[model samples]
Target: MPDPELPVITLEELGVLRAVHVRGTDSVEVELTPTYTGCPAIEAMSTDIERVLREHGMRKVSVHTVLSPAWSTDDISAEGRRKLREFGIAPPRVRQASGPKEPVAVELGPTRTSRPVAGPPELAPVPDPVCCPHCGSADTELLSRFSSTACKALRRCLACREPFDHFKEL
Candidate 1:
């Protein structure tokens, strides 16, 4: 099915279409995972999927949204990354192993006992450097944290002097 957000890419290409199960000759069920929670395109995507199936003579079409396995940038297909780049949107960068280190205990008031101290891991935002899709340059600056959508950020390339959208990593 077609993706409602990026029309050039199919839902499979975007890696959001999870599964398709045929219940019978005229019945079908589809599973989808949204790229982000409360993504505006999700309802549109569901409607589009149902409409597409009905147009093809499917009597019963059901679209289920599953969120158990959270969506990640890594889930995006390689072709999807290429397509994003081709469309002037930088795909998410490969995550490195250099995320914030785990917390350590610190002694207090010369006491033998100490408690571990650190912010919640979930609250830490690991900033990944985005490359420029236009010139493939790593010398890019964040123009804004929010782009055209919540799932993206605006960036500008120093090399090409071109502004582009970056698919932010979740």
Candidate 2:
């Protein structure tokens, strides 16, 4: 099945097509998970799936959306990432579970006690250094948070001086 957003990548490669259930003859149910909540392409994808199934002579076809176990950038297949990069969109970096290692703390000012600072957990990973899709240069700068699509961001490479879209990690 094709991805409505990125047509070059299939739904399977996008990791949204969860499963296909066939109930007896002439009945089929397709399970899908959206890349993000309230994704604009979800309804289009469902419609496409049903149309394809009907064209294949299925009398009854139902598309179900599953939201549990929210989708992540990790869900994108290796092939998908490769395709995305080849299409001039930088693929998301694998999210790090923990922040960078911190240096050992030292007590100063005759105070032996030091209190740890607490903050809310980060909702998303810090943006990784982006490489230019045109010249493969690591010296790229983010131009804007939003790109042509909601999931991407605008960036420019210092080497090639070319602007490109980066697929932001969820």
Candidate 3:
């Protein structure tokens, strides 16, 4: 049971801390999700969690690693978003699926021509899908998919030209 007074955050919201389940007074199970598929922080994080739980008198603490139900920016809570920005990282933008055949451009040839030429509109894509913390610029460009970690991407602000990390979209 979750405490009502305390704010509830998904494991992703906590970043390192995943799920904690209490089986009994002495037995407990913890589920951990890595920042990336090959993240090295897993060892350190697992040790830290173990130490903390042990300190709290969790005797039979078992840490289980889960990879399913992949992590996503949506899984991150508002508080998590705040923390990420504070840590100099941008959150992933929420992208809704557009309707099928959302016409970009439909060009009807010359006034007398009957041929119809349809092409994708040249509308500027969302620069920074997520709002940029630096310079408060939403206009951003994806620098690299691989940042310092696989879970983050290197993004550059078009207005500021300052590069920052963007949390991956799941």
What is the alpha-carbon RMSD of candidate 1 to the true structure?
9.6
Sequence-dependent TM-score of model 3: 0.67
Our tally of clashes for model 3 stands at 1
Given candidate 3, what's the lDDT at residue 123?
44
Clashes of each: 0, 0, 1
- TM-scores of the candidates are 0.79, 0.79, 0.67
Residues 1-170 of candidate 3: C-alpha lDDT, one tens digit per residue: 11111124334564445678998887788888765577676666667667778888889878877776544445566777776676667866544343332222333234322223344445423232555767768777766767876667788888888888877665
Candidate 2 per-residue C-alpha lDDT over 1-170 given as tens digits, one digit per residue, 9 for 90 to 100: 87887887899998899899998788999999998899999999999999999998899999999996677777788899899889998888766445552332333332211122345446432335777777889888778778888988888888988989988777
Question: Residue 69 error for model 1, in Å?
Answer: 0.6
- The window of 10 residues in a row where model 3 has the poorest summed lDDT is 1-10
Off by over 4 Å in 1: 96-128
lDDT values for all models: 0.79, 0.81, 0.61
